[model samples]
Target chain A: MDYISRYLAWLGDGIRDWLLNADDTGHKFALMLVAIILFVVVMGAVLLAVDRPKRVPRWLVTVGFVGPALLMLTFGLVYPGLRTLWASLFDRRGQNFIGLDNYILAFTQSEFQIVLRNTALWVIVVPIAATLIGLVYAVLVDRTRFERVAKTLVFLPMAISMVGASIIWKFVYDYRAVLRNSEGDLIAQQIGLINQLLVWAGLEPQQFLLNTPFNTFFLIAVMVWIQAGFAMTVLSAAIKAIPDDIVEAATLDGLSGAKMFRYITIPSVRPALVVVVTTIAMGTLKVFDIVRTMTGGNFQTSVVANEFYRQSFVQQNAGLGAALAVILFVLVIPLVIYNIRQLRISEEIR
Target chain B: MTTTPPPVPALVTGGVGDDDAGTQSSRRGLGLDQRAAKAKKRLTSPWASLLAAVIAILWTIPTFGLLITSIRPQSDINRTGWWTFFTNPTVTGANYQEAMFGSQTNLAVYFVNSIVITLPSVVIPITLALLAAYAFAWIEFKGRNVLFVAVFALQVVPIQVTLIPLLTQYVTWGLAGSFWTVWLSHSIFALPLAIFLLHNFMKDIPPSLIEAARVDGAGHVKIFFQVLLPLLVPAIASFAIFQFLWVWNDLLVALTFAGGTRNVAPLTVRVAELSGTRGADWHLLSAGAFISMIVPVVVFLALQRYFVRGLLAGSVKG
Candidate 1:
């Protein structure tokens, strides 16, 4: 008993020093390695013990397999989710029950009204615009000479983190006020691509991300740029899966050009189109990174996700944040249902 | 069902004069397959090709612009747009050097932190989900379907909904602001999707294979290790790539838990902070952005096939 207690004390000290108090990279790595080993040992023992001479009970084996995941999910996801829902009804300190006051503020407050309005705009615009662009681009480049390269060029943005993509687009939208020399000749050169194009077109350079309502659209452009690739990849596969016989029959019927595309292509890929739209919508609804990185949700551009982060962490209003998060979760439920319905419909059509 | 190799080589190697006659003859007296090919050719009008080219260029230009800015001298980058680099042609590596090793930026440490955070976050979830998925796929238990559907439905609950309470819980457990918290949070959030995807893959494995193994005195563990695991390598690889990229490129989890300190923050968190604070520091931001993007882009390009397979199988948020 003494030896076991001493061993556990030593282990506790090591964990505290190496993991909880991990201050260096070496210590962090060591802690990670130890945690991995501990997990492996525990799991290995469960499997080995169950595999021994006399067979373990079937239920025991099932428990050994499923217990760890269920425990983690319950503790980490299910509990936290329920707790957040409960806390949304309380005050910022989570000590007093406010009884839907947080939800009322979220819906009625002028500031949060804009957040909700902007999120609605994002959910509506991003999916439609991205899907349209993706569909058109997919059709135009369906089997082009450089099909692989063309698809990859668009798809590459999907690989970039929203943070990286935000920085890239923010640079593209960079603005510098025009200046003149003593002689009144224009001296300041435009640095951002869009502003330079504006200057070249004999129009005044605009602050793309500074204007209140329009800035939100510019941010939405970045999302569409990233998601168009996803839409294209999925729809392209759908387009390819359209049987050649159908295409030949359409051709024999003299269905060519826009006529063919409208009559056959769109109808054929409707299921993929629905999936892409809903998927992008769900993704856009929870997008906090782009807004956070580019504008920090300033300029009246805060969506629900960013507002939730701000209210929770930045403003220390846990109740409002939880309400916003709950709102986001509620918003996604419909999209998921619609997506599954469309998937089933398409399967039935097939 | 006829699959003719596209006339790509002919289009490339054939001279303009020969190209027309060759395609024209092939267009004549052909099957519906050949007629469909001709119709596709007709669809690829010059206008269509130009439109495709324009969209491709539009998609490629932003990243290309950033890549150019990352390499240009800081003074030039600040003075003019990346498009202007073609006229001036000045270049430098100072930005990358400063963003990485300089005391102010120190993205190198965060880069290591990303690697550390990603590996365990990827490995642990895959390990746990493998066992859970096996049970879900093969084990006959009461409430199995209900439990599987419950896990699938959990994907709808955005991580945002759970962040606050999870953070509080982490603090209670004395794990806040540590790599362990980040790892555990990511693993937990990833569980639903991982279990669902791996279960799908496991379900595809033939029951006969498992039954044959079980008939030879193999227990569940033996069947799992000796029978199922060998067939699961590809599925595991696909999911690993997916999870690796998701964790590496993630900002929200890292920012919430580990962004408070340089000791544990990943590259995404640091780069995002740089964007906010040093918004005009183009040189550092550009270099930092690329430094963060390089790993995922490389992984994506190399294992694109697996990545796309995973994407198609389940593209839900990680």
Candidate 2:
């Protein structure tokens, strides 16, 4: 017993040190490679050891294959999830029982109400705007020269991290105060793209991220920029999936240009449009990184997921944070249902 | 459907050309001449073509500005916008140098942390999900459908709801802030979607293949590694690319489990912190953000086809 305890203590120390001293890149790289290989090998070995040529026990095979995943999910996700739900009913300190008070505050309080409003605006605007842009772009570049290059330029943002994307847009929305030269003539040149255009058009540069209400839309623009690619890709495939003969018949029936797009193209890709909108809406609901990286949810820009992080980690209000997360969970339920329903409808139509 | 390739390529190019011939023929100028005159007549409506070009320019210009900024002198970045470089061209590697090895913003360490966190996180989850997906797809077990439904439903549980309790448990187990904690947490969060996606792909494979292996006296493990694994390459590639990008780019998970500690915190957390504390330091922010985004950007551009396949499979009926 003493030996085992000592060995465990030593093992714990080793791991703690390794995790804490993450600067030695070479050592850490080698260690990580070893750890991954060890995990794969151990799992692989157990599976191979259990298999028999002549006869295999069904339960044994199942246990050997699926057991680790089930165990991890139950412990890491399921139980922790239930615990958080329970914790949401407790007070800030998790000591006193305060059933539904946090949830009530989430809906009633001024700050959280703003969070909800921002989330609603995000969900409503981002999907529509992104899908519209995506659909338009996809249709435009369908068979044009350099189609791949055009699509790739739009889709490139999807590859960037939200943090990366926010910086990119933040640069684009950058503002500088107007200044005057020695002759007292104004020489204010806008730095950001949109602001520069505004300057050239004789309009005042706007504070894209700081102004109230409009700021949320500005932030949503970043999301739209990133997600437009996804919507375009999926919808493009759906457009391609429309049988050639159906389109051929439409063309013969005098469907062309606006007539074709409205009558045939739009109807054909309705399911994809639904999928793109809802998928993006679901993603928009949980948009935390952009808010965090750009304004840290300041100036009435906080969404539920970002609010959850601030409350739990920064503010130490566990109850409210849990409730915010629960609200996010509740909000997604409907989108999921709607998405599934549309997919089913699309399947049935086929 | 079984004997022939999909009719998409021909139909896409041909139908698209025929449908747009009317509107595009009228646009005589505006670079329409670059296209072979025959192809120009078959292009999109002039308005649409113009709109696409505008959107594409708008999308690419931001990153282009930042890319220019990342390579510019710090004084130049602060004094003028990236656009000004066209008139007065100047460049430097100082910001990248400072963001990586400089004080308080040594992103090189965090970049390593990202690598460490992403590799095992991707490998472990994909391996485990493949095993579970194989069982869910092939192995006839009691309550398989119910179990899968449960797993599928769990995908809706946002990572936020799981963070506090998971952190509490990690603290109790003395694994908080460790790479082990992150690896385990990421793998757990990824299992539901990974299994669901892989199961879909696995189901598309004919039962005869598995049965053929079974008849040849191959056990489940043998068939999984030898037979099913090979045919599932595209599907595996699709999910693997998504998982790679997801893990590498994740913020909330890393911040929750590994915040405030430089050793375990990935590049996103560090870049986010930099953006907040140094909001006006566009030089460092541009350089750091690009540094963080470099890996995924390269991976995405290189394997774009698989990435698109994943996107379609994720949203479309594919």
Candidate 3:
């Protein structure tokens, strides 16, 4: 027994070291290969064991497959969630029980107030802007020659990480407060696209990411840029699925262009529109990456999600972070409920 | 919340009266003058075409600029706009080489870490969720609907809410700051949605098949493996791609669990840190951004139908 425990711990340490401490990438990858193989074998063994016993009880077989997922969700999600909620009630170190102080601070404090404001701005602006752009594009390119290629251009960003998009847009917004030459001609060029366009228009290149309040909108543009593709793709399908008969009838009603779009097409895709708006809203609410990568949540561009990370991980302020996280969860509930309600309503209409 | 936005302009470029069914590439480059005067009439509304073209160009330009910048010489990159490539074109693989293996930023390691972290994160959640999904769909458990809804509701728990407590738990187990922590964290974050999506797919399968198996003395495991698993393949592929893209692109969970440590941190963390710490290095940023984007973009383009199906599944019933 003593040897078994000792051997187990040593094996654990060695595996951990190989996986987490190896200097060479080849070693780490090789170790991952071995570990993944072991994992598959163990899973295969469990299933094989259940398979061999042909007359196993219904409930036992049910539990055999479902139990692992249930246990993981319980330990990984449910317990930690409740713990975080509980921790939100405590003070900075999480030792003292300070009722509502963290929540109050998150709301009333000047800095966190900015976070709430930024988050609100994000939720409001990103969805509407992206959905509008996406819907417009989806409608125009519904069955055009270049429809797939056009839609892919926009939807491509949804697959890319927010980090990548931020870098992409950060370059677009990159501003250098460059000095001028003898004829006031620029000696230093603005490499960023937006700034260069401004420069081309003979307007002074503004620091797009540094100016407060406006910077939030600049950051929001990145999200809109990415999410619009999602809006277009989903909404396009819904438009296509609108039965051909409905379109034929609508066309016979003298609805050809803008009038048809205004009256028929919009109403037809309402469910999809709701889905797009709410999904984008929920996604926007939880967006930390754009803020993190673009500005590090500086210049008052921090939203609740980014603020939560800043408070918890960077500042080590557990209580505030927990409170911020709770606030995020709270904020998301309405969107989810709203989304579910929309889903239900759409189902009824169908 | 329920109100739809105004319908986009109904400028159908191809009119209702027209069927370009026989239209092929032969018509593509033919000018209205060269082909026929009536070719111009094929456009129902030129204004709509113009608007769509403008938006598409606007959308593509940012990435286009970055791609140009990525391949440009470092000195030229800093000196001129990427659009200037049209006039004085310069291309080099130096930025990619430097970003990948340079002492300052060996992004290649983090790219490998991204792959490592993403695969297990994707595989575990889908596997576990399939089991849970099967149970929810088929089993006559006591509180099945309520439990399923509860699991679905868990999706609303912003991952930030779980990070601190989960991190503390990991530290207690001496697993903090490791790939295990990332794998576990992503798997956890992914389960609620994965389960919900798969269950929706599973419930759509006819109960008669399962009933027939049950009548033949087959148990849950046998029914699942022999009958349901085959039908669930497309649904599973749809979700596998969804989870694959989600895990690959995740930043918050990765950052929280992996914490910028070279051995575990994904490309996102490294790229983000570079933007924060060395904001001036557009050369490295462009290459790194492209490196991170290339896989997901290719996956997206190739398997787009499945990806779109998953998106619609979340909204419109498939």
Candidate 4:
């Protein structure tokens, strides 16, 4: 027993050192190779054990297949999820139990109230705006010669990271304070496209990301930009899926253009439209990157997701962060449930 | 939540079983193809085409601006809008050169780290989920439905709820601030969704196929490896691409576990940090942003058919 324990310790240390202590690119990639080999060996062993000629118990076979995933989920997700929930009940340091205090503060405090408001604003605005744009674009481009290229143009953003997308928009929203010559003539050229457009219209250039409440809208626009592609893809497929007979019937009834779209196209894609809006809402609810990259949640632009990160990692307020995380989790539940329910109904109809 | 409920869009529409969805793509397009011809006869709405053109431009110009700016010289980028690049063409590789190899922002190192982190993260989760998914789909045991449902429900647990505690545990295990931590955490987070999706795919396999293998006295492991895996290649590819893009483009998990260290921090974290600290340096920011985007964009464009299939499966019922 003593030898076994000692050998296990030695093996663990050696593996850890090999995987973690290596710093160079060669060593890191070597580490990846080692991981793959190790995974293959372990899974091979498990399969061999289950494949013995002697009859194996059903439960043992199940365990051999399922144990590893369940073990990982237990340690990594389930146990920690419960712990975070428990920690949210305590104070900032997560020591003293101050039940619901963090939750109360999150709801009542002026700062967090703004966070909630910004989140609500994002959830409502991004999905509707992106979906409307995507749906309209899908209808227009349906079966067109340039449909592929046109769809790709809008859908490209979904391929880029939120961080990258944020950088792009941040450049678009880039502000250089207006400068004047001695004669009071405008001297500074607007670097940002948005402000440049405003200048072209003979309007004062506004700081799109610095203004309160409205700044949140600018951040939300970034999300809508990224997600509109997803909406377009899903809705485009749905539009195409509208039954031929139904469209033929609508066409026979003299329904054309807006009337065809309003009656046939809209009704046919309603299920998909619901799924797209709710999925985008769920995604929008958890969007921290745009806010983090654009404003760093400054100027009252924080959402629940960003605030969770700021509290837990930045401020080291585990309790408050956990509370915020819980709030995010709670917020996502209804959306998921609704999404699944809609999918089931859609599936049944199919 | 209901018992044995389907998982969220990340799974249902995760594009995992998209091969099944791709075959139906032609059928879905049938209605619209016919509608286009009839609609042309009624009234040609030039306004619709114009609106779509405007929307396409709106969607594209931001990225286009960044792309143009990334190549311009530092002075040009700072002094003027990227739109002016056409008239005053002064392109330089210096920004790309510096953003990649320069000190204080050696994105070259982070780019390697993203690759190293993403490969194992995608591979490990898919392998484990394949086995687990096979078990859920084929193996009959007590509590099987319950266990499968539990895994499905786990998808709804926001990753934020698990980060801090998992980090503490990683620290306790002496794995904190390592690629192992990022890889392990990503794999773990990816498991529930992976299992749910693969299981859905496996369940769709004809039961007679499995029964035939069973009648031949082949074991479960053999059947999984020999019979199902071949059929599941498309499914695996779909999820692999999805997870690959996800882990590569991810910022939060990498940021939390790897921090700002060069050894383990991926491109997203480093690029995000650059945006914060060097927000004014469009030369570096634009270059850095593209450095991160190039791989995913290429992958997406190449495999867009499969991606759309997976997406359609998730949203529109297969």
Candidate 5:
């Protein structure tokens, strides 16, 4: 056993040294090769194990189904969750038991207050804006001639991931110093499209992403843009599900346009509207990619999720970070429960 | 809550047409007059439909800018508005070429890595969740409802809370910076939702079919493959698309588990890198965005029917 431990230690040290000194391209190629080999070996073992003549027992099959999944969840999810929860009660280095001190700091600290406030703003604003726009769009394009075209165009943003969306919008918020030609006329100053358009309209090009409250709104617009399609698709189906006879009866009673929508359509689609609001709210709680990609959490635009990453990883304050994570979890649980209940009620109605 | 009396008798009686019908028609006529009065009321109000259209157009501007930016040259991108490219029109393939071939940054490698991470990240979760969902739905077991609810409750726990512990575990297990680590992380995060969704779908499958298979010589495994699996195509496809999109577009798990190595970094991380180290290269970033979008768009368009149908099934039914 001692011999084996020494050999393993020696092998690990050798590999670490090689990794440290090796050229980047060579190391990457080597890593890819190893990954492929590992995949082949693991898959081969599984295939071989399952190929036996005697039928794999039901229990074995059950284990096979649940084992890897359980193992993964234990290590990747449950263990980490418990560890973080425990860590949250400790100090920065996770050495001393600080109890609710970190939690108190999280609520009392000014930066954390901003994060909480911004998160609330996101939850309140983005969902309402996105859902309203989506509900309206769904109603408008319900039976329109260009419904498919319009919906596909609108849904196009949903197809782009948050990272991709951020990259796309980063250019929209790009900035550059003004430049002039030899003639001293503003020859061509390029930056963000909004800034460029401002220049074109003979107004001063202002920094869009750096402004505090307005920048928060600008960021929320990105989320609203991406989520509208999701809301539209779900709500459109709910709208479609309203019985035709009820609509006809309402029409016959001379309840037309907005009145019919208010009395009939909105009530019928209330469950779906709840689902949309809660889902978007829950999604807002996990929003880190956009902040990370676009602003790197700069200019006082950071939310709890981004700050969690920054605190834990960048600043190496595990306790405070874990405290933030718990706060986010607390925020999300109610929305998730509400969503689940809404789903259950909808299902029961169906 | 106000408890209104059930209107079943009123509904039934309202169907009869007689002397009351004349009164009802007159009332309806009065309502029509009121609607006309409301129309007059709305003539002076804001055009809500026009406002909606304006909002939709406003929402699309960023995307329009991205499309134009992808086609323009870096010089032009740095020099003028993307809108100006419509008038000047000096498009270049340099950004696309660089993104695909990797001049300074090897984005193509990250794209391939994304495929590696996503395919299994999608397939493994769906496969495992299908079996688990089948068990939860059909197989009589102790603690089934408790287990299902537990899994469902797991969705509420933020992934950030688990990141550090997961990272430490991966390092301890010697799985850090490996493809397996990312795949495993994604599958773990994705499984609760997948199982929840699939269980809902599987519960809707008629029980008689499973009993009929049991009446024959079929075992659970055989029944799962021959009968239940084929019937689960729509559910599987829907879950597959959701999982695929989640994995493909994932940045957090990939960033944490795969580390910063170019070989392991997915397209999301690669695109993120373009902003920091390659900030001035908006042209490359835009083209990279388009390239990364191609797979998801194709996946969505190809399976859009299944996607829509599955959402309806998952949401409306269970």
Candidate 6:
């Protein structure tokens, strides 16, 4: 351990010296900047060349069109995915193969089960609640007096980054047990807003983010608050797409109110509903920010993404983290496939 | 089966005219009935509107608290609910001053870093996706369907799987901790969805318009810029908002590659530091959080209409 620390410090010092001394790092960095600019220039040129009379050579077009995309995916995505999968089958140091032992451990561990359950709960609750709230808001605000204003207000949370949102909510959940007045009288003041309100209502100030199951729910509320605006916009468009003539026909048949919605409205907007639900579901499956920011996945609130980060980076148990990542990939792929298929089908109908 | 012709032409025309007037009166009565129905809807379902209002308020509570905390003194914040500041009215800009200038971790510098990262991230993907979208929509090519499907399928691969391998690759390439690495990664991750969305919108352009341009010797480039790009303003604007918000808010990639390093770290990473190391400083955090939120809020508000139009444009069309 002493040797490792000494080596790391030495390496850090060496890198620092190199960085300070070398003019090439700056030059190379500048060249990279120029390359990025040239990349744009070359794309524009290729776009212009391809649009010309004879059409740029088919080979040039193909290379121009597909080269960057293929390179990016291979280097950035495919390679990483394959490497992670391979690492999952190895030991913590990634030197020896263990062949599914990590997977077995993941299944058997109580904490892993809790993570899975909490993830499932998040996937189930956040998407549904967000979609429903958004749909209802869309319906209420559709063609109303305050449509733009209401939407702008609700969508405000989406602008805040997850870390920022977490910081904001942390203060909302801020708790300090001890307090004193200038006179030095002891006061049991709860700093968190919800707890203060609880106390005001003549109840005990509860630790909202410390409790197990309820804490998970509390964390989910933050995501729902952020996502509901997205749902509202998508679902609102779907609602608007319901043809007026069909609605008028229903009214003619005296099928007013709830009956009209059941028979005509929902069926008309099924495609949008599928898109909204699946999009939210896919997002929920990889939820990391709220969990990471609020509790750091403590107190039985860890999901797969957060746990994967902890095990791989913090704990340096790369094998288990890779296994969890593989599981996440498996869960997300089917949803992506379904979403694409749905998109294609919707296009075909159009 | 033949029915007998009972009426003469004069009587048929006269009777039709009389019925038209009668129907007009009855339609007026129907209009009154519609008004009554609308009134009943408002009266009976008052709870629906009330419920929406309540939910909106509930949703805004956390953000409201943060805004209040940003204005309160650190002593007041540590000792009381932000709501207490509402009644007591002991507001101060000291936290904002401290968050901005007092700390070694300068948030303003981080904000500039975020802008530098975000602009390129938005620009690169949109530019690449525009070409790809044009090809997918208009140009005929071999294996197009398979390629599109593959790209779409790439969306399913969780980002966690790619982080380490990409990091190792960046290290080997000597690009790790560089802005280009983060920019390229953001662009790559954003590209698949961008192509899928932009292609959907591009397909909505009338085929005849492109065919006309092609016949007139307008090349793909000419048509793309002169003909198609203008029409795609709404699409580009909307996707820009999506990509901008995404890259700006992104913490994971920023953490893995550009984290904790001065001169390169983005706002998300900087804001994250406040909580972990300076956890006791609630006032500074609240102020920093608001600062971080400012750009995205402005971006959203400025481009919201385009966002809605773009979403519908992508989804509802081919």
How much of the true contact map at the interface does candidate 5 reproduce, as a fraction? Answer: 0.44
Estimate TM-scores for all models.
0.93, 0.91, 0.91, 0.94, 0.84, 0.84
Query: Which candidate leads the pack in lDDT?
Result: 4
Residues A51-130 of candidate 3 have per-residue lDDT tens digits of: 64456665676676778788888888899999999999998899999999999888898988888888888999999999
The digit string of per-residue lDDT tens for model 2 on B193-248 reads 88888887787899998999899988888899999999999878877888888888
User: Could you give the CAPRI-style class of model 4?
Assistant: medium
**Model 3 steric clash pairs:** none
Sliding window of 10 residues with minimal summed lDDT for model 6 chain A: A19-28
**Residue B107 error, candidate 2, Å:** 1.2
Interface RMSD of 4: 3.7
lDDT tens digits by residue: candidate 1, B1-318: 001111111011111112222353354433555545764686558888788889889888888999999999888988888988888898899999999999999998898889888988988999999999999988888888888788878877899999989899888888888888999998998898888878877887989999998889888888889999999998898788878888988989998999668889999999999988898889999999999999989987888777765554546562
Q: Score each candidate by Cα lDDT.
A: 0.84, 0.82, 0.80, 0.86, 0.73, 0.74
Question: Once superposed on the true structure, which residue ranges of model 5 sit more than 4 Å away at CA?
Answer: A1-64, A178-185, A200-202, B1-56, B308-318
On TM-score, the stronger of 2 and 4 is 4
- Maximum-TM-score candidate: 4
Q: Rank the candidates by lDDT, best first.
A: 4, 1, 2, 3, 6, 5
Colliding pairs, model 4: B13-B314, B15-B310
Computed on C-alphas against the true complex, the DockQ of each candidate is 0.38, 0.41, 0.40, 0.54, 0.25, 0.24
For model 5, residues A1-350, the per-residue Cα lDDT tens digits are: 99999999999999765543333555655654555565557644653464332577555655544556566667767888999999999998999999999889988989888888888899899889989988887776554434565666677677678988887777777777666789866765766877777877987766667888778887888898888877777777667556657877887898866887789989988987888887777787789889888888888889999999899988999999999998888888777667766666765676
TM-score of model 6 (CA atoms):
0.84
* lDDT of model 5 at position A165: 85
The interface RMSD value for candidate 6 stands at: 12.5
DockQ of 1: 0.38
Model 1 segments beyond 4 Å from truth?
A1-11, B1-44
Q: What is the fnat of candidate 2?
A: 0.61
What is the Å distance of residue A161 in model 6 from its true position? 1.2
